[model samples]
Target: MTLPAKAIGAAAFAVAAGLSILAAVWAASAIEGKSLRGVRAALEEGGYTWAEVAVDGLQVTLTGTAPTESLRFRALTAAGAVVDARRIIDAMDVVDPSALGVPEFTLEILRNGDGISLIGLVPSEGAHAAIVERLGDLAGDGQVTDMLETSEHAEPEGWGAAVDFGLRAMEALPRSKISVTASRVAVMAISDSAAEKARIESDLRRRTPQGVTLSLDISAPRPVIAPFTLRFVMDKAGARFDACSANNEKARDRIVAAATKAGMAGKVNCTIGLGVPSPDWAEAVAMGIAATAQLGDAVITYSDADVSLVAASGVAPDLFDRVVGELESNLPEVFSLHAVLTPAEASETRDGGIPEFVAILREDGKVELRGRVPDPLVREAVESFARSRFGSTAVYAATRLDAGLPKGWSIRALAAVDALAHLDSGQVTVRADRVKISGTTSQPDGRDEVARILSDKLGEAQGIEIAISYVPVEVPEVDLPSPEECVEGINAALTRQKIEFEPGSARIAPSASGTLDTIADLLKDCADAPIEVAGHTDSQGSEEMNLNLSRSRAQSVVQALMGRRVLTGNLSAVGYGETLPIAPNDTEDGREQNRRIEFRLLRIAEDGTTVPMALIPGPDTPRPKARPGGSDSAEPAASE
Candidate 1:
């Protein structure tokens, strides 16, 4: 008890150090005890008893074994919370429940503020939603985020309607979206483009569904334009002509008056032609000379200014002449007076005299002489003389006129010459014996000269007979063979076989071998023809299996044909399978017949020989029916 001050201080320090050590050890033991209790509680709840727990101060550690990774995680988590652990060390081994013969259900929950996320392969939409709702209930007011994956579980028989209802529900929300995973459908929405995308989303959503989720990402518009073309053609007559002449004082008056009467204006292009000068030949010539003197022939010939009184609307010849007379009286020095009429004798004569001929001179310096003459000889003589004088370049034959009369009659008479002058170049028409030749000539008196020649010739010919003749031309026709005939031949050959097959099989029965032999003969007959062997089957069994079987049957036929010495290259095997069945498959016999092989002619040579064996149908025809004792039935002879 009696000690120095320093020793007393040292003793007090040692006691305090021991107490601190004891407290540290006790805290460690308490932490370990709490961790063990938490671990035990977690293992019991999770149905695991083999797991171990340890603690060092605030650090908790889980060890040993557990039923699964989930169980190990749960044990550590429980221990950690109780010890208020600063750290958790996991050294536990997880046992796979599948390997241990235990059913496993995986649950994952994610929370971010007011949003929650869930993800796992679920059996159905209802189960997935139920899990989400449970999590939501646990989270209380926090938003639940779901990213659940699902197995492809088929929707129940009547659940399609329920799925459609869910789709409708999703459609109601402007930002709602729905998609299927496995048999389960997930729904979510959160943007402004959701309403438009809803229609697509609604189509995809299902209460009991499976497969990949469908998404709508549409965000743009389209464009349009008008369709057709309008067109028109100019009339170039009537009102159009009136508008063109409206500026001219005299011509405008006439044209405007005509247009007003017709009631058509401003709608189309008008074309006008200079009409015949005048009804009175002598008067017309006099008027023409006067107009030519004042306005020059070019202006007078403008078509509009050359209007004839005979063609003028609302104006009689007498009235027109009175107007002309008054103008001539006032401007007598500007106009000349002369008879536009031809000489009286010349008018009466069928062939006009020299004076009458001069009066018909056109403004362009050309004249047209038209009349009938009586003598053929005169016509021929004048025509010959004119041709000799002018050459073929200047004199053209327009037409020939034949008046019924004795043969070899002179064509040079007045009647014959008149008729000759009216013909068009190169035109020839036969009537009776009298021939009137007419055409344009270099000389105006050519017609008269021809008439005189005809008269002289007619005097020589008393009586004779002649016959008309013409040659005929012929063309040859080409001959070609018909495609239908060839196709018919092939069909006939097939029909002649009269072989039948069993349903869903390509095995040709022993009975059908005779038909095959006949087919072989047909092939031999068409040695040069290229053939296509095709196999067809009725719609039965899986598509893949049917196609394979058809191909095998077709190949088998090709092999058979090749064995018969048919050229391999000439024959080609093709399997159409159910695609080209010739018969219906709804009935037993129909299906039997439908499962068959056929040979078709692809091509033939011109010589009808050297047929390519490849073109022959393979022997894969129809299989015969099975006999009662499992023996194949024999096919009848092809001829029978």
Candidate 2:
């Protein structure tokens, strides 16, 4: 085996290289085994019961579900820290098995640039606090964004300790003295039964807790009265009050007894009537007639007296005196010697041709008269006699007669003027008794004709006086075009413009200039009418952008119209944007058809009708954008 020194050195180097390669392979195998064991142990310790761990060389990969994000992070950190592992890849789901059935309690933990966000629902306030505390500990210096919600459920006991609540309701009224129960309480009172019941119930309910109920019962006493009866009768002939009558005494005794028993004291009335054994019929009749004549309406009999009178309409007061005097003279024996005649009531008499007249009886028993008089001679005589006899006792009772016409009398004149005014221009003023007509018209002959017609129609009415005056009537100038005419004009303009609107956009091609010119002419012709320039867009862009574009387009149209001498103030611009897209935006053709600009007649003063003017395409030429080298082009040049 002995050889030269160079040969030995070369052989030794080859052997050493072979041994170094073998040792490197053995170290790699040991590190791989150690890393696998470390990962497996970490997953098991972190409560990832279903996880599988694998390690290759310096890399550790985890595949499993951890109970919480903290547990997953801890497991990954532990695996990466192993001496053999250079990198770690975690594919673990931090999901709690208990929270699977409770979607509301499930939480998602996300780490953002700013902080950690916790989003989910908790079972209770306690649960939420616990979650926050646990996450706060894990977060350390990081902020936790909590978007958790509370679970709605019945509160546990002891939650209302702040409120002083008692087991039983406080006793208000006594129980035995009154029928008392949970819902209802009853009481007895000798007086003010209703008031006492209400007061007690109110106090009890006010003191009662929020969750309690209440009811009330009361018993009231009845009023006492003394029982009694009375009887009386009317005699065949007559009845009168007599102090010595036995019937009167009996009635008085009964009344006194009843009053004494009922606790009342005062003057008590008692009725009396004649006994049975009637008087002779012939004597009764004669006495009755004599009494009637004396009393001016009274009856007299052997045992009774009654009075009655037959009044005459419009009879003079002197006639009453003569009749009374005659009765006194003829029935001196039956009538009282002091028989008197007095007017029962005074009243005014009303009849045709005679003003309302009132008669009075003087103190010396003479007649007096006052009121309106139909004849001068009669009036003078009545006034002089009344002043001489009654002095200042006479009353004025004159009646006012209405000679004016009724309310509806003016209706006839109104009808006549209305008919005539409809046919021609004129001003008519209606008064209580007459109508005045005057005003001028463009046609003098038409004014005269209207005045004649009104006069003829009103002359027949005797109640209303018609006064006709002819003057100039200023008619308002009717230069405004009708809605139909305006619409027709707008349609004609649209027809001439060959280029129709592209659905909703206001962009018009070069071909539409002629139509736009026609529209300008129509607007100029209908200067009085207010035109609304509306811009509409398809539903392609955002609502806000579309709205702005529409508004800008509408204003552009208004500017163009103004260039043609159309008053800008008369033309208002409105943008409906994509809200009122006449055509659908779903298809390319439909989108192109939805965008348009339209001129609408908003108002017409002649007939107060609003008509849509017409939809006309704007200039279809694309607006030039900035280009390189200062050249005008439709497309914008690319920036450097």
The digit string of per-residue lDDT tens for model 2 on 351-418 reads 43322333433323343333333445444554454444334454232322323323543333334334
Return the TM-score for candidate 1, rounded to 2 decimals: 0.19
For model 2, the stretches where C-alpha displacement exceeds 4 angstroms are 1-480, 495-508, 603-640
Give per-residue lDDT, candidate 2, residue 321.
60
Candidate that scores best on TM-score: 2
Model 2 whole-model lDDT (C-alpha atoms): 0.44
lDDT of 1 at 380: 57
lDDT of 1 by residue, 1-640 (tens): 7899999999999999999999999988887777667767866676656776666666666778776566667776666655554577777887754566312223333343445566555446555654554445444586767777543354344233223333333434434444433234445554343334544444444322344233444331211101000001012232212112122234334533443443335533221212322223223323432432222111111121222211122234454456456435543232233212111221222443221110021323333323332345545564564444434344433323435333433333333333333322312222232332433434322332332333234321211111111122232432332433433454566576644444455555566666655665555444334456666677988776777677667666655554454333435555666766567889988877777777665544343432223333336744332211121111111101
TM-scores of the candidates are 0.19, 0.20
RMSD of 1: 30.5
Best by lDDT: 2
